[model samples]
Target chain A: MTNTNRRVLLKSRPQGEPTPANFDIVDAPLPEPKDGEYLSRTIWLSLDPYMRGRMAEAKGYAANVNLGDAMVGGTVGQVIKSRNPKFKEGDYVVEYAGWQSHAVSNGAMSMKLDPNAAPLSAALSVLGMPGMTAWWGLMKIGKPKAGETVVVSAASGAVGSVVGQLAKAHGCRAVGIAGGKDKCDYVVKELGFDACVDYRAAGGNLFKEIRAAAPNGIDVYFENVGGAVQAAVVPQLNDFARVPLCGLIAHYNEMQPSPGPDWRLLLVKRATVTGFIVSDHFTDMEGFWKEVPALVKSGKLKYREDIVKGIDNAPEAFIGLLKGRNFGKLLVQVSDDPTRS
Target chain B: MTNTNRRVLLKSRPQGEPTPANFDIVDAPLPEPKDGEYLSRTIWLSLDPYMRGRMAEAKGYAANVNLGDAMVGGTVGQVIKSRNPKFKEGDYVVEYAGWQSHAVSNGAMSMKLDPNAAPLSAALSVLGMPGMTAWWGLMKIGKPKAGETVVVSAASGAVGSVVGQLAKAHGCRAVGIAGGKDKCDYVVKELGFDACVDYRAAGGNLFKEIRAAAPNGIDVYFENVGGAVQAAVVPQLNDFARVPLCGLIAHYNEMQPSPGPDWRLLLVKRATVTGFIVSDHFTDMEGFWKEVPALVKSGKLKYREDIVKGIDNAPEAFIGLLKGRNFGKLLVQVSDDPTRS
Candidate 1:
């Protein structure tokens, strides 16, 4: 283990798409575990679309990451030192440890990880925030009934993959809107989605292809990447359709705000569009932990990770994530996972 | 009483807004009631903003008014002839009697009106579709809590006026948006809304005026008029805010569909925006009738109607209504109300 903590800090807020100049990497002395706190070596750092909102000065659902601070992120780590009675040396934990090699936690929101049940990194992917997001948003908000058509955007990504799979489990036909042919293939063949529309390839035909894919019209739309995709899906929404708007990654990088779908469609269709953040619904965590991990263990749910090596490459990889360059749940492996063979 | 039925027919669909050319009035023979049917002399014809949608080629919540057909409308009439056991001569009834001096009804959605309980025309305004629309949309969808601010557009109009009063009754701070000074004054002084912003006078400062009116930020927005007012109100919505999209009167006359407010605001506020039409929720009618009419009788729920005279003048008054020229619930009194003093 390194004696120094290499941390990436927010240098500036991005006007549009984030560049490497907006981030600053520096080596600092490893943080010490004070009384009732434990220091953990960050093994995996999750790069999510929401992190883009955190870097903006605009008030989002959550607070923005202050300038010159370590960029906030979800992390899976191993405890190397401890001062808290609840934690011990060598204990694995999933916490909001930010973009660093190590972090000190008072164990407020940190959860103890069981590497034997699933890979430690899985806690940062399918078994973690993204998975629970899909479960809660789809079931509670989307409310897909049997024989309904459920369509999800960014379908190959962390949250969306689980969304499509869960919709299928609920006896709804799951259709996916993805960026490329490769991702579309993975969403349909590997992830077991009924069909997947390649938005990149479809170009002007996106709406037509989506309409063909969701022949009976969309009953529940799991909105992950909003923009042109949203405009297309909205017109085809069935009467009393539910839209669980989890993310708007398409607009996160824009310099100016874009207009949403014509609301006349909502009134005509009697649709329900709800915008939500998973953090506000933490009360569902208990139920999620009970049901989701079992599904992951039984091979009912599948997940993919685009793992980038080293913390130094995180800025570039994150930039790629916003542009749809990375497939699946984008993550940075800061160090080796001891549980992985 | 007139021996001929002076019916208004839909000559053509309007391109942007309805014109006199779009309608054709003709004198036709008075219809006889069939075995199960009843003939009535039309006393009041309710002219609502939703009629604009019915005249359009685009598919709205309900079916479009077919060309050459009598323009559909809600009416309060006195039954002059009856073949059905449910009705008797001189009995007041509220039914879809169209834009004519007389009509026949088989009693599908027709409601028996009691002039003694409240004014027979009250069934077409305060106790009818508009009142029920305001009641259901605000309570069921907006779901405003005590100490929260509820803002509604089209403040002095039939639905919006009732929405503000109901919001006030629910312990919410009721703010309204109307077109001009007179309507704004009537909204605040007579109907008891906390404040009313004049959208025509506010100009570029519309949002500023609205923000000032709703100092605590809007928690519930009963959307009766969309477009600029919606764009202005959306930014001030607080966390977990609810928006019951009841109408888009502002966009109803447009040749092209206008864009809705930036959805990013919805995401940031975690708002629930649901679109609904009162017709779909007729089950609420029983509860509404039991509760709302009593409020009207006690003078708790105030109402006003802008009554125009004669069946030949219906087209002009309807055109004026679309332009916000009518002050209150716009209605055309086709014939004398014997029940009225």
Candidate 2:
């Protein structure tokens, strides 16, 4: 088996918005697995906005990616050689393998991905963290009722797409906030959202636009993006509105506290705002897996993937993700998938 | 009856912090009680931070106080004249009687007050809105486990004192944040709080002081103040912390949004923040009155009221209340309590 592995290391922390210089791409030899460990070749590397938080030295839910260490991420990989009884050679698995082509694991965080049920790449995207995030925030926290207006930011992206679709499934008016005309169009047309507000569009106030879109006022807000988008939606919230704060992607690159409206907005609406980490609520993932895939298989729940080729390009893809450049679930196809053709 | 009602009217909206000029002292003729109606003389007027929100023309939980209208507030009063069967003459009741010395009501939002049980003044304080506010936030939202650390801002004030005492009763460590050393002393020494930090002290960071007070990290936060105090508390919050946002007195006077940390602090901690209006949760007040008085009777709960004399002093007292000049629950004794004297 080839021992050579290519890795992308976090060279330096970003001051504000991350640039390519902050990442160092290098080739290295993979170490052999001892006793209870196994070697896995990366098939899919996830490029998420969460990685931006991991890059900051500032305190967050996850530890920051230290200088000269592999930038931490979720990945789908296939075992090339095994020293553990639980995993065998050619078996596909999903794990936190970071930004590396090869990883040696004792299988503490790794979970077996069924190759027959779905594509191995789906493990790092749809059928994995992002899917659970959308499900957990929408069904668990947002708790949208039938005929209620639910709004999601970054609505064409990974988690937001699922949130809007799930809102529709639950008999809600799903209004999405997306970056451009294309994403906004895709969010409404392809993602089956009731309406999509183009945040990039100029002229009238965005707050007024959101109010017009959700005329009865938002009841369930799936907060994946913060800043002007959050400011706009907060005032338009109905009494007893629910905000499931899944992400703050818009403020991840912010140098200082964003100048925004006070908690008075939340207080005035008597809203419930909850911030949750997907890992903390994984007990419900089984229910999500059982439900979402069936919806996906029947074409009732559709998904889009933005697959950028190779591990070296992961840094640029991740940076673009923070800038709202990626249209859907962003992934770095690091190597050829053994589970697929 | 004299038929003259002394009132404090909201003459003009304050530019920033409310001043004496924003209020107008006026004498108006009291309307005669007609069929199915009654007239009540205000014995005790309750001054709360929530009134600040009502003063703002912006959308909030309740309607804004229109210019030249009597400022709204809760008041405990004796029914002087009654034309209704439910409320007889000379019976005590609590109602939203605004800032007027006398009011006529149809008994819609009025509740009979027990004059024999506690002081009629207690109907507007410990045994009333503020006490219930503390209980609802601490139990419904905070949900503190035994031995968990709970932090509350405005610790010596009406709601905070109750919250701290309640936390202790529930077997939780209560750390308080107050504006001065005297209030801090009252919170810690008198209220049985584990510790209290003086937010106005020099040199040391408020966050550091809070961290020191709550060594294990804050599990539940009762947010009454929301400026530097909130900023300090947010970072010290432990994972899965609950925040019952009852008020933002610190931001109430602000012309714009206070520059503070984003909700990322909450998201990273996986915190639950609920903003509530006590009026919406009055169904549980029956339960509060039943249980809380028992605790108070057994010396498990202690309350102190900072009572100001005269209906004329209400405007200045309310202005001082915003400045944190009052030591405890701030209330204006409008007239001689028929039950007390």
Candidate 3:
């Protein structure tokens, strides 16, 4: 194992689409575990859309990542040293270890993961925050009822894939909007989505394509990507439609905030729209754990991961995530997972 | 009484803002009521902002008024002839009587009004649709808790007036936004809103003024008039703010649908926005009746009227209403109210 800690730091804030120059990969002395803290080596570093919001100077739900600081993210790691009685060396855990190879946790907001229960890397994807987000936004806000049509944007991505599956599990018709033929095929054939629209190839007929897919019109829209996708999905909403505004990845890269869809439709349709963040709902984690992990373990719910080899590649991988390049849950493999082969 | 029924018909659909030329007041031959129906002489005709939407070809929650067809409206009238057992001659009732002196009702959706309980005109405003709309949207969707700041638009107007008063009754800090000094003063001084911002005089500092008034940030925003007012109010939303989108009168006359507020704010604040029409929620009317009328009768809930006399002036009065010319609930008195004098 390397004696040095390699951290990806936010070098500059992006004006629009993020580039590699916005981040700096640096080698620093290994961090020490202080009293009531345990040090862990990051095995899998999460690359999520919300991190883009934190890099910007503009205020969002959470505080921005200060300039020259290590970029913040969730990670699955194995403890190397411990001062906290609750955690010990060699135990695998999940915490906000950020975009770094090593991190110290006081066990305040960390959870232990049993590798035998699920894949260690799954702690960063299907069995973790993304899964819980899908469960909460889809069930709590979207409130998909049986026989209703549920359309999800970014269907092949981590949260979207889970949302479509959950919608299907609830006996609702699940339609997906994806970027390309491969992802569209995966969403339909592999993920069991009722239909998947290839938005990139749909040209100017996106609205028509979505309408054709959802013959009864969309009732619960899991809005993962905003902009054109949202504009198309909105007009096709059924009366009393519920939209859980989970992410707006398409507009995150725009320098100027773009104009949104005509809200008159909301009034006309008598729709309910709720914008949610998973962190605010962590208190409901027990409810999520009661269902999702079991579904994932039984092969009832499926997930995919696009893993980059190193922490140095996290910046490029994350930028691609914004552009919908990563096929599934985008994660950087920071170190060898002792639990895995 | 006149031998002919005077009716206002849709003459032409307005391209943008409505004009007097869009309507034609004409006299039609009086017709006899058929079996299971009653004929009534229209007394008070409600002129509301939503009427602007029905004049155009664009479809809304309710059907459009066809060209050359009498404008559809709610009215409080007295039955002159009855063939239906549910109604008796000289019974004062409220129904969708349209913009005409006489209407034939099957009594499928008509309610008898007791003038002795309150003023007959209150059936068309404070104790009726507008009042019930305020109650449902505020209580059901806005969900304002005690100590929260609730801001209402179109203050001193029928629906907005009730909304502010209701917010205050719930122990919330109620602020209002209206067009001029008179309406603002009336909202604060008479209607009991904590503060009222005159958007006309606020100039470019509407957001600044609203933020100043809502020092703790707006928790519940009763959105009546959209466009600039919505744009200004949205940015000041506190975390988990609830917005009940009751109307968009500001955009009602625009030929093309205008772009809406920056929806990113919704995600950032984790806000919940609901767009509702009162017609869809008539089933909840029982709860509304249980609370609102008693408040109005007890002098705790206040209402005002801007009455334009005679059916001949209905067209001009309605045109003025869309431009915020009416200071209160805009109504056209088609005939002398026996209950009033």
lDDT of each: 0.93, 0.88, 0.92
Q: How many angstroms is residue A191 displaced in model 1 relative to the true structure, after the best TM-score fit? A: 1.1
Provide the TM-score of chain A alone for each candidate, in the order shown: 0.98, 0.97, 0.98
DockQ for the candidates, in order: 0.87, 0.65, 0.85
Clashing pairs in 1: none
In lDDT terms, how accurate is model 3?
A: 0.92
Point out the higher-scoring one by TM-score: 1 or 2. Answer: 1
Candidate 3: CAPRI quality band = high
lDDT of 2 by residue, B249-338 (tens): 888888876654578888889998899988899986776877799888777788888999998898889889999999888989998886
Clashing pairs in 3: none
Tell how far residue A289 is off in model 3, in angstroms. 2.2
Model 1 RMSD to the real structure?
Answer: 1.1
lDDT of 3 at A123: 86
RMSD to truth, every model: 1.1, 2.2, 1.2
Give the number of the best model, judged by lDDT: 1
Q: What TM-score quantifies how close candidate 2 is to the native fold?
A: 0.95
lDDT string for model 3 (B1-341, tens) is: 56799999999999888788888989998868999999999999998888887887877888899999999999999999999998999999999999999989899999998879999999889888899899999999999899999999998899999999999999999999999999999999999999999999998999999988999999999999998888899889999999999999888887786887667889999999999989888886887888888898899999999999999899999888888999999899999899776
